[model samples]
Target: MPLGVVIRRQPGVTRWAKWVWRAVAVLPGAASADWQELRREGEAVEYHAATLPLTVYRSETEAYRIVLAAESPSVFVVLHPSEEASPDRPYVVHSVTVSAHEAQQALDSGEELVEPVPMPPPLYAWLADFVDRHHADETFMKRKRGPAVEMQSEDGKGDARIRQAADVYRSPASRRKGELH
Candidate 1:
């Protein structure tokens, strides 16, 4: 499905960051948009940054299931600082994904910003249908424990081979100091 990324730019509160760029929403099955200005209110402005393909894989239905199970199901928008970044628009839309793990991976990079935009109704329905068709619960197989070892009761007798003259409960470090081997 074609996904359109909508980025919002607003004046930053801190001096360190002059402008804040964040992904506010996504347009599903939207036509190709290239930095198209959508709305403006005072200093805040929203842009249709890019239109990218949102692919749903059969293998990743489980990840999608986890995404849908959330209280507020959302699509994660990945944004990265552009090379030609300016005071007005510094970040660019990188990608959009439903997989929480993938979003986490993007976040772990420490370079890209990940924003979770609420899943639109049509997109949610599409994802639900896809998951219903492809998703299958994986059966958990519990492994049995191996045969237990018969533990010997040799309390206070440190190493049966070594004979202690002074302290019976001498620490292993103290014993190592005296012994050459």
Candidate 2:
């Protein structure tokens, strides 16, 4: 089950203030709540969203591990367009996650204005359970290369007999030319 978190932000006052993102509150497991307007410009209404359900799956265990191992483990609250497709309420909560690196990358890439908040214990436990259920341990098998062949083919040219395209692709000259060998 996905639990919801209400993310709140206060509007910036100075000119440079708009560039910074701050989280006011994170209400966990909230069913529903009132919508607060974020900003207004020429009748364009943007609302601050409450209650974004943070979800995780077993398939994301590796990603969760990376997130948890980060120096600053945090939950990111992302904003997006509303579900009903209304011009008035242009923004809503898109997703929330514990991946601090992902959140920083999203900000750096200009994907969205994400708010990073500290993950509460309950929410962390919830995500841990999801990952535990969905995560699978994958085993890797070492691949053995074919037995060493005579460097010199039947012909004294020292070049491999061109039986397939891979021969040309794996040629030293081709490899030097930046082809994958």
Candidate 3:
């Protein structure tokens, strides 16, 4: 499915960063856009950043279900720092995904910014259909433990086999106190 990322650029609170960019919303089945200005208010500007394909995989239906079950079902948009960043644009839309896990991986990188855009109504329906058709219930299998091996316990002693000394628990400092110079 084709998805458009809507980014809002606002004046930064800090002097270092002149402007801050964030993904505000996503447009499902939206036409191609390239930093097209959508709206302007005061110093804040909203742009249709880019249109990227939202791909769903059968194996990732569980992740999709987790996202869909949320109170506000969201599609995660990943943005990476653009090497060719100008004063106007600093980040590039990397990808869009329905799987929360995939989005989480992108977030864990710390380098990329992951924005959760509310899932569109039509996109939600399409995702629900895809999950319903491809998702399979996986059975949980309890892991069996191997036969327990009896081992010797040296409860107040630190491996007696290493040293048969009676003051095994005593510190080396104590031994030094009793030593003759």
Q: State which candidate has the highest lDDT.
A: 3
lDDT of 3 at 57: 91
List TM-score per model, in order.
0.77, 0.53, 0.77
Per-residue alpha-carbon lDDT of candidate 1 for residues 1-181, written as tens digits (9 for 90 to 100): 9999999989899999778788999999999988899999999999999998898899999899999999999999998888896765677778899998898899998999999999999999999999999988889999999887655434346666766564566555455445543
Please list the C-alpha lDDT of all candidates, in the order they appear.
Answer: 0.87, 0.58, 0.89
Could you tell me the TM-score of candidate 1? 0.77
Instruction: Write the residue-wise lDDT of candidate 3 on 2-107 in tens digits.
Output: 9999999999999997898999999988999999999999999999999999888999999999999999999999999989978788889999999989988998
Q: Which ten residues in a row have the lowest lDDT in candidate 1?
A: 172-181
Please tell me which model should have the higher lDDT, number 2 or number 3: 3
> Which scores greater on TM-score, model 2 or model 3?
3
Of the two candidates 1 and 2, the one with more favorable lDDT, higher being better, is: 1
**lDDT of candidate 2 at residue 65, scale 0 to 100:** 66
Tell me the number of clashing residue pairs for each predicted model: 0, 3, 0
Q: In candidate 1, list every pair of residues with a backbone clash.
A: none
The TM-score, computed over Cα atoms with residue i paired to residue i, of candidate 2 is 0.53
